[model samples]
Target: MLKRLFKLGLIINPYSGIGGALALKGSDGADIRQQALIRGAEKLSGKRMAIALQALLPLKNELSIYTASGEMGEDILSSMGFNHVVVYQHQAQQTESADTKAAALELIAQAVDLILFAGGDGTARNICEVVENHCPVVGVPAGCKIHSGVYAITPKAAGQVVAQVIKGELVSLMSGEVKDIDETEFRAGRVIAKHYGEMLVPEELRYIQAVKMGGKESDELVLSDIAAHVIELMDDEPDTLFVMGSGSTVDSIMQELGLSNTLLGVDLVRGQQLLANDLTAASLLEHCANKPVKIVLTLIGGQGHILGRGNQQLSPELVKMVSKQNILVVATKSKLQSLQGRPLVSDSGDTTLDEMLVGPIPVITGFHDLVLYSVGSM
Candidate 1:
């Protein structure tokens, strides 16, 4: 005989995107937060959450927010003058995955209509373990690498989607995969991704991103041809240093050269030998010091991102070392087709670098085949 107020849950992994601009590759655990900060990585999650929450301010009175204390959620909501209830407490600078899980549990107990989180795939994994379809959830893109389908295309998009839901719009729900990667291996230039599980997510097709699909076995032949083209280019300039960005297409080139490469991390090669196995932004800069270098990358399927998605190791500074003219883009015809006429995108977290990447760039789609495609901010 009682009606509950329309309630929504909020969680913020304050350190989510800290590792990105620092060129840490991925932001998964808490230990890297300090290292990121030391490297001048900004606390992007809070700022991003604020961006998302601002969209809901007009309807603040119609919905109530249940969230964790401090940086987790309360601080942002309070500052925005939104109506929110803190149901969980956490340490200021010591919040861990455990804290995220505990906060999710508390939010679920409060019978919130939906749970919106801010973080990367790892943060999604922690929440997936506790939520498990208990309520609808969404993600605000504020991480280094987001391979999960639950996230909005951008923080502003996330706010719009949540605002629509809070207004009682009839939005469908779907199960979104929670993708996780090994940070140690990732930093080592080896990407090992595993499916943790799935969670209920609000389906706003225009705003939400799809889960990152794995490299298909059928793409091997196409990759091999692409590799051959890159190898020939390398042979002509034996003295030039080639910085390899992660992806199966680029990995195929290393395989063709018979050199070991980090499939999910940056690698460096000089002539026919491997110069560096896996490299961070600092390591990349160190190795390429005073050396003429070129960057080789492949477009991310569906997303059409050539940088700033899963390849933070290729930082703007490193890109400067390589120079845009020396950068090589590789993709198969099918992969390019997946773009659906949209231009390739870049979000390297550096506004100037992203601007430099604007306009048409050549993409190697096959052996001796080049296609000029436009690059824009995502």
Candidate 2:
């Protein structure tokens, strides 16, 4: 059905997204991978690659893929019956970020038409370091916290983009930011994201996502209304443990309650008292044991995500302990509208929990103002 015979480059960060379900926050370097596995984390990026490659199968005869051996890319592409050449070989026992960089360098040396990689922001950074603006690239969203604009909205969307690229349908190239968060601070329930660099991504407005937004805004009237509503609810249940998530909107409620809250971390509040400040996953679990708990979260502006972005401290296990009904979501009208009517996303790393969070969820926008918004997997 397509006539173009392009040299496509494929690379996979086999250890990408491994730290997600384990609640390790960010998956970078070999030590993280080993720790993730010890904590029972499974391989996800390879399966994500399989999903994207399936979509490009129809172009098998017309595409020549250059990739690394084994889990990087060759295994999946070869099994899919696509013509591929192994450009790099990994050490097998130790595949680090250097392996990814080597693969990208070899792919660039081959002068591939397009490079497709499966990982989170870290993998994007590795590829961007070597192939910046030299060739078009697309990222498959398969990480714990994806703050990069290089990733597609979903893996299926990434597949669609890859197919279109092979068909020569997408012609625009736009710069996408590659960001990385401080893993040490992240595991401690503090979010510190920094922009590493940028990469050229195939521009298809439908598939690309926006970079994470930061900073604060003060809306005294509206924030006061939202804070009053939340305070009233907290007052009704004196014994319930309230887990507060980060963001300016949520911070407003904490300020009104006269309790200290983390501006970029998760905190625990119970009956007008600050029980914990910037609690880690293990610490939250330990404190919440045998206690009735509720989670209060705020949406990320522009990106409709209430979980799995910067609040990795509220791990999947901790969320399951609280359940969805006990979760409180509060956001401003402008923040909700910024999503353009899309449901909020949760990449909490636990697939079953993500599914359980699906369907229409209630969000408190203002004083007694409620909206039932759908929740989908990212």
Candidate 3:
């Protein structure tokens, strides 16, 4: 194969998902090497790095690489066969956020065409903090929850997008949702998502930008109207589940059903049984086993996020089992009008999950007209 001029930048946060894996309290803080060691696991940023490597390995000889130094920098590049230029090294606690900041800056300084990174929401925020809009960036989902638009749906999907970009394809660089989740709620077993900002996704990119849920805000949306519509749509099937995700709009549905809701937490109601209320991923998955479920959701206002913030209950794996087609969204017409041109957003923590829910899904508010929010809109 002829070599290509694809210049890429990458980074990894070693201590990301271990906390969830080891029952270590949380995804941040512990300071892995800086604080103390637990059970011989030296805090590996390897997971995220490995994902990015898989995306890039196919075109190793064709691209020039810039990366950070140390476990996050040298180890992955060496193992992947790319001779990368190390820009900065991170301390052990140096999670994806720190490394991403360093690598993005280096790529900007080097004026590389693209910066491909590996991490979740925190890492995405770190890059947004410093990324020059002129430099296009993409993310490889490797962290606990990657709700950033910059990431491809799957790590390998990111590689294919890069392949297209370098092949001189007419790719439109669209902004994907830069979403953040509240670490505070995470420990309490609640999902709380907030919009950090936006990132660019080269157009016609697949597996990177999921179907965006809600976007912007409109003065015209009436919560009551959206609620009424959802109530009418419920099949009222004997065993069919009506899992309402967090947000005011879904709350409207709950209100219509005469059931109390978390307002900002996941709620599950099936045939009026209220199977599980304000469920966490563990709880939802346990109970949802082998059952047909219908998720009645609402997109967050302004930032347009449908998941991630307060609905972490919907894990990427769980979402896959549910199938993308199973999701049902409810947003006020005014909210849809407010979207104007921004795509809906979902940071559900998992990039693949984000992709699954990132595009244009149907939004219901009233009887006749439906609102549409697309990943390309923003």
lDDT-superior candidate, 1 or 3: 1
lDDT of 2 by residue, 195-241 (tens): 98887676442211111134232357667777887888879999999
Backbone N/Cα/C clashes per model: 0, 0, 29
Q: List TM-scores for all candidates, in order.
A: 0.53, 0.53, 0.49
Residue pairs with colliding backbones in model 1 are: none
> 46 in model 3: Cα distance from truth in Å?
2.6
In model 2, the Cα lDDT at residue 311 comes to: 95
Instruction: Give stretches of model 2 more than 4 Å off.
Output: 1-4, 205-378
Q: Order of candidates by lDDT, top first?
A: 2, 1, 3
TM-score of 3: 0.49
RMSD of each: 20.6, 20.1, 18.6
lDDT tens readout by residue for model 1, 68-144: 99999999888889888899999667688899999999997876767888998888989999998666788998888
- The whole-model C-alpha lDDT of candidate 1 against the native structure comes to 0.79
Error of 1 at 107 (Å): 0.1
Off by over 4 Å in 1: 1-4, 205-378
Once model 1 is optimally superposed onto the true structure by TM-score, how far is the C-alpha of residue 351 displaced, in angstroms?
A: 56
